[model samples]
Target chain A: MSDILPPGSVIGILGGGQLGRMLSVAAARLGYLTHIYEPAANPPAGHVADRVTTASYEDADSLRAFAASVDVITYEFENVPTAALDLLEAAKPIRPNRRALAVSQDRIAEKDFLTGLGLTCAPYAAVSDMDSLQAAIAQVGTPAILKTTRLGYDGKGQARLRSADDAGAALADMNGAPAVLEGFISFTHEVSVIAARGLDGAVSCYDPGENVHKDGILHTTTLPANLSLAQRTDAVLLAARILNALDYVGVMGVELFVTPKGLIVNEIAPRVHNSGHWTQNGCAVDQFEQHIRAVAGWPLGDGSRHSDVVMENLIGDDILRVPQIATEKHAALHLYGKHEARPGRKMGHVNRVTPK
Target chain B: MSDILPPGSVIGILGGGQLGRMLSVAAARLGYLTHIYEPAANPPAGHVADRVTTASYEDADSLRAFAASVDVITYEFENVPTAALDLLEAAKPIRPNRRALAVSQDRIAEKDFLTGLGLTCAPYAAVSDMDSLQAAIAQVGTPAILKTTRLGYDGKGQARLRSADDAGAALADMNGAPAVLEGFISFTHEVSVIAARGLDGAVSCYDPGENVHKDGILHTTTLPANLSLAQRTDAVLLAARILNALDYVGVMGVELFVTPKGLIVNEIAPRVHNSGHWTQNGCAVDQFEQHIRAVAGWPLGDGSRHSDVVMENLIGDDILRVPQIATEKHAALHLYGKHEARPGRKMGHVNRVTPK
Candidate 1:
């Protein structure tokens, strides 16, 4: 067992987007100072963090000083450069570990790890070149998704293979980068369970949230997903299996395709998930605070939902509706403080609470 | 009546205590930037705010600069110097207004104002000097408390005159400062109502929280206080009446003594009260966020409680229980991140939720 850091200890966060911003806020609530190490200028997380180091991941001196200043380090995203982790891990412990990052950073490796645990996932094959793409298509078949193995999110670095004839086109989309071809899922709906694994190895999973995506961007997440009690229990157990398998030390978003046969794992995010944002207004212990508690080695809090909430993403022009949403009695507006509201950018979200 | 400031506008907070710190966090949630103007170095609020100006309130140049930088100003306390308000009000609007500060700054004026509004309070008389103190004591009778008219809080500047013989010594305890003698109220318990008003004259009030004080310092605030439906209705009405009377644009905490016959207004704080901290875990929109929304000219959110909560202050060494409390299910720790834990200092608080 490791010594739990009391108040006044600094937590180093590797990303400065909205997820990191919220994590810093949660850390501060628990009496911990946050040092945000983000390469981007004027990061949203820096607005609430105690200190912000503006330097690239390649800046070894800056990374070293940041690591030295903090008692523990955690990243808001899985794509943190391995080199930066190499520098920071030598100075301080990184929660969630590099093994989880390595598996998540590669599609083929992630599927292999999941299958090794006897978990069900979509059919996928490694596509290294045109020949591999053709071979993988012959196995996984058409109506699949071709995606880069690393550094892709929000539907980026991906192409859809509608038919066998589109194989060459999909290969062209990869541009020689290592890619993944996943067979299309005939899921009734998509759901995600946000699970946290404590340093003590205790796992807690929040109720799954049913998600709706528009143009591959999350549109809304409705709580109490239309699933039977048995499905809910199965989803949670599968999520815990993933967390335990990874030896995860923080919150993980496990996206699943709910089908007639059972639940099929879609993808996993090593940080707070956008689909779980409804917990901010629906549960007493939110995902952000849960993540902070897990990273800080504190006990996992109650993740039970107190209120039914429907969360809607405020993307680009959706912000214009804030004037109306702000007046809605049960709607809690959560803005990210982002200056520009460009299309597809997650400016903020509003959680509308409904009485149970 | 006025335009609500957009999200990115800066909010200037006047105090640097835990209240300000929580306020800054709340402002950030609403997508507003906070700039803390505190006289003390490394103020708790500064750790979360986007900017901090550490200069004495008496410093005219710093005060001017702080006011100019923010779109609107609101304070975390009622005792701001009149001269400072005079300078800041010329640059930007200070919420809760000067009338609130003037009335709350002087105990005599506060009592007069409350009585003028036909509110019932304990028998009291102002003591300008020793002769007046003697006369006030004779009128208010024995077992009365003598408190300084200005700069008194948390049982700090008050002395209990238990008997007639203790009058001279109690008067001497005032140290020649103006004071008030009040006949102690015989009440079953103390409850406080946190109410807010908006720019368009809208009002919202949270349920009353019953408070217990130890050594005149707040010990705990238990929600769903033992009160008849009529008493609850009266509490909300009285609180709304006070807000409407002041044309208040922020949250106010109204403390009342529950007597056998009816409720008697004890005193009021022009800002968020310690008694209302339970809202952090009990309600969807907490007192801090309510204050921010009102000051920002945004529409008020629902202030209804979602769960029963008991909030206990982590004063001084009480923080030592944080490790144990962190493991307690449904207990949410909210620490101020103060560097030192001095005696009687409010280091943080724990909001224990009762799953009703």
Candidate 2:
């Protein structure tokens, strides 16, 4: 096994959102210094990190300096450009590796990779133009989603095809960028398994949580998801199998569609995920610390739950409910230091832990 | 309730130790800024806080500027001189109030306050000199301890009178300082309840943990302490009563001696205590964050444990065990970023959490 980075070693982090902010806090708790690299002024992560590099991701000189200043590198978001990853990889080790990022950055690549791993996914086809779109429609039918192959998040860059009449306008709106058409799968519920794989190949997973989404954004996650014990085991095993297959390091979130028959892979997040936020107040080890330990080449913490937990996302104006929420006997509130609670933005979350 | 301080308000902390360090991190997590006002250069708390004020306690101008810069003042250690507190209190509010500090700062006053509250304590008497020492010996008897009335911590400024013959030398060594002589009480075990009280009079207490001491410093604390249900309830009630009595507005640690008859109050800490460190990895709301909420006049969080935990102090070279400890399946390791690990110094702690 590789020698784990010692406490006090600097870990370079990409992106300065709330995820990065939480990661910095976790790293600080473990006696590690964090250097955040992000372009935004007054980034949320900058408030707690030991040092910060405020520069554009395309700035090679600044990125190079950032890479040289840390023992290892990790990122909070997967949409980081491949060029930036290449530059960081040349200077220092980048965890979760470029392969994981390569697979997850595009919808087509992610579906193909999962299917290649012998995992089930919704039917999908790449569409480069109207010809491909027509072909994909012929194969996949209407009522499918046409999404850009890259640079899409939070319901952006996607359109729904309800019938043959909707296909042309969807293809025309693509503006010539590469895209993919995926047939929608009717599933009973949505769930996610957040698991971590250590450098030593050890894997541990928290219990799967049933998720509810509104407007393509996560709204809530309730633990002890409505899966039979056997199905829960299968879900966790599938997550572990994917981690081992990718030779992945750090925590990964596997979003799955739980159908009547079985589970189908939806997407993979190579970093600490929003759905795993419940672990902060429900389990022995949180996803942020688990990710840090894995990237630092340390052993994975136990992912056992001691309470049945429910996590509610506070989007936009919902943050104003913090005062009332704080009065609850079982609620633990966490708010990100964002200046404005813009609509659809994740401002904070409150975890309610009940005795098992 | 008074208006809750906004996120950008600065909190002035009077000590720059591990407790201060953790408090600063907690404050930042809640979006409030912290300015550590410590006399020592390069204090541990300075590593993570937004700002640090390095000036002696006697520097009135610096003290005034620091007070003016912060919205409110709190302290990590209870031994701050009354003069320093007086200077700061004139400018900003100090949580927990000066009355609690006055009562806790001196051993004689603490014992008197506890006894005055109709709380059980070991037999004790004040000793002002040789004459008073002899008189106190006659009243409290032999096999007692003579401790200086003020400025003592971690077993400093105290002498044991194991036999009647040791009394004269113990008195001489005290150097004419006001002192307290306490008759030893045989106890089954030692435990502490870490609890918090908010401005609204809300109180929350973590389960009392059995503590083991080595060389006068806490070595370990195991949760679900080997105490009967009644004993646990009584311990928590004692802590809450103390908070109510002091009108405390932050986290407080109440140390108790578990005698065969019942539990007896040992001492009280007016701020976050070391024994509560397990909350960082085991409970939903840690003592540091609880303290922040209280001092900010915000509602308190639930102090619920999600896991059975054991927290072991990493004193000096013990920090070298981080790698081995990190390898454990469920160990959450935390290290203070101290540049040097001198003997008897607390460098960090590792918490092992197991499902209940």
Candidate 3:
């Protein structure tokens, strides 16, 4: 019981977004019950989870109660409040650990960790005030982006500089938050490796998936990404290196920029990544199940895909195409139970499988 | 909204068993919520469903409340009480319709319906008293099965007769319940067709899966059953005929006995069957989703399989093998979340897929 959270054990999930919803369903498949904790009144995950605690992370009593009710805790989003984590951590185990969360919460720490592992990353510098902003621009050069180190997701809290002349305006977009200035580099495409590390120190990495973004949000991810064998191996190895360094115990999405020189570490998400959604149709054990298996102390599935798949996210009005997509052959539609189609909001996704 | 139950719609399931649990998960995938109604406390489906009403079916208030909360209603078990259905049906539409349920609820009605469709069935006669029981035995002969006409499942309420001398004992086993004597047919094998009919009157049928039984319970079902082209087509066409005749609007399991002359109709279930569980691994759209789609008035998926699969049920202690089965490649384990592994209880199932 101490090692494995057997079937019927309740798993507490910190966020109730699509990731949490998918994870809840995967846990249900393995005969585990899930309780979702989210501040939102009507979270998407609430529809599928066994229980949903609608309370803010700042509510100490609620956080403690949630932690007490479950065998272990895992999160969908990495920005869980430190005070809340402190209380919950004292009550129950939080998977992927605080170090992994801490490293990913801050862009500067993530970049430092990656570079420290001898991994390649874009030229970047930290920024606090106008003086540092100017210095960051001078050091990183033109065509850079200034992004807040925390609470940045799906292209929010980011401002891009076309050249040095735009540095002042881009810095203003930071709104006095701690920011990082990253110099842009020429790259062929972007790819991500969805990797996992188990309690037993076993690592399994899915094949690199080529990513396409629209309006700074992920648009699609296609499997069997165009990569030299060396680049593919480098992407997987670096992802493993990050997980190992953090002593991670769940699925992590490692984003990389494919440059002519080498693959550059762009960023990493401590939880299941949108880029790995294609695995739902391509592999026998999907990313969500893999995460649940790892956190539950079960044996890891060898990351082997049985089909070639192209996963396209249904952002906002893209859900309008579900009727037509549902009629298509080999298309598996996964909707997040989102009621409204707000622009840029992730509504759902479709994985189109091409049998090998 | 009149034609289709859109995402965010709540689907009401009548039984809180493993089938309802799976159906709830599938509905969640399509952005639908589910509420399960069952008499038992802490049902397996309650872990995954949006809500669970733990009240007896005879409670008209509970049935009405359950039906009123959801846009549409469906059932996982065929034996749902007619009185409870009457209350629910008055409040909401029940998919597969009352006709399908009525016909499948009683053996005599099911046999009559099948024979009415010009389908072949085992020779049988209904009996209610001692004189009638003797007459039935004389008509069907020995080496037959005398089963209760109503509420029989998994070999329960059944008594086998080895000779004419065994008729009185087999009749006594019925315990004054209405009975039917069916002459056993020498069949080479048994197969089942998982078929679906949409609201648009379109029909789709999955490939016939050969089944093997142990202790009168399903042990395994293998895909691509050894059926000639004509036999396969015949099996599917007959299933479609049954659905069309009933004006069914959901997935139906049609079990058939493959005899020397042709495929004989064994029985019909107006919901997802255990034999079709293989579709979870073999098809793009599984039987559960197909049922949900049909009940929700969505277009039916053309039943197509991408891989060969053998689905084996984990009865009782067979669940203990999960630790080892979890490590096997290409084997997908699905557990019911039931606490005790009682003998003959279906604990879970494993779908072993063979990719082409």
In lDDT terms, which candidate is top?
3
What's the chain B TM-score of candidate 2? 0.98
Interface RMSD of each: 1.7, 2.0, 1.8
**Weakest 10 consecutive residues of candidate 3 chain A by summed lDDT:** A1-10
**What TM-score does each of the candidates earn?**
0.98, 0.94, 0.99
What lDDT does each candidate get?
0.90, 0.88, 0.92
TM-score between candidate 1 and the true structure: 0.98
**In candidate 3, what are the lDDT values of residues B178-217, reduced to their tens digit?**
9899999989999999999999888999999999999999
The residue pairs in collision within model 2 are none
What is candidate 3's local distance difference test score? 0.92
Which pairs, if any, clash in model 1? none
Q: Model 3: clashing residue pairs?
A: none
Candidate 3: list runs displaced more than 4 Å: none
Q: Report the C-alpha displacement of residue B99, candidate 2, in angstroms.
A: 1.5
TM-score of chain A of 3: 0.98
On DockQ, the stronger of 2 and 3 is 3
Could you tell which candidate, 2 or 3, scores higher by TM-score? Answer: 3
